[model samples]
Target: MDKSVELLKLGSKIRELRMAKGLSQAKLGAIVFKDQQSIHKVETGEFNPTYIYLLEICEGLDITISELLDFKK
Candidate 1:
């Protein structure tokens, strides 16, 4: 897979999880100590989040890294 495609898929997956939990970007950002714009960037694949950042996102979403990265579903 292309790197851009992978990033897009990761972004989409995060968006899906956020929506499933009924959390807005602003709200989730608050939980993760990020701004809404930052969350938007992540969800749009405009940002390449670091491992620690991903951990924070997963924590905010109440999920494990395994769950977050398990795109096989």
Candidate 2:
């Protein structure tokens, strides 16, 4: 797969996992030290999240980096 497409898939997976954990974008943003718009951009694959940001989010969500990156299509 192309790199962009992979990143988008990973983003989608993160969104799904966050929703499953009952978190809104704003709520997740609070844990990640970002704003709602930033979270929204991540969920929508409109922005490529930074490594540190992704790590912060994963830690806050109690999930591993591998789990966040695993997407099935």
* Per-candidate RMSD, Å: 0.7, 1.7
Writing each residue's lDDT as its tens digit, candidate 2 over 1-73 gives: 6867876787788888889999998999998788999988887778888889899989979999888876753
lDDT of 1 by residue, 1-73 (tens): 6878888989999999999999999999999999999999988999999999999999999999999999987
The lDDT, on a scale of 0 to 1, for candidate 2 is 0.84
lDDT of each: 0.95, 0.84
lDDT of 2 at 68: 80
Model 1 residue 5 CA deviation (Å) reads 0.5
For model 2, the stretches where C-alpha displacement exceeds 4 angstroms are none
- The top-ranked prediction according to lDDT is 1
**Residue clash pairs of candidate 1:** none
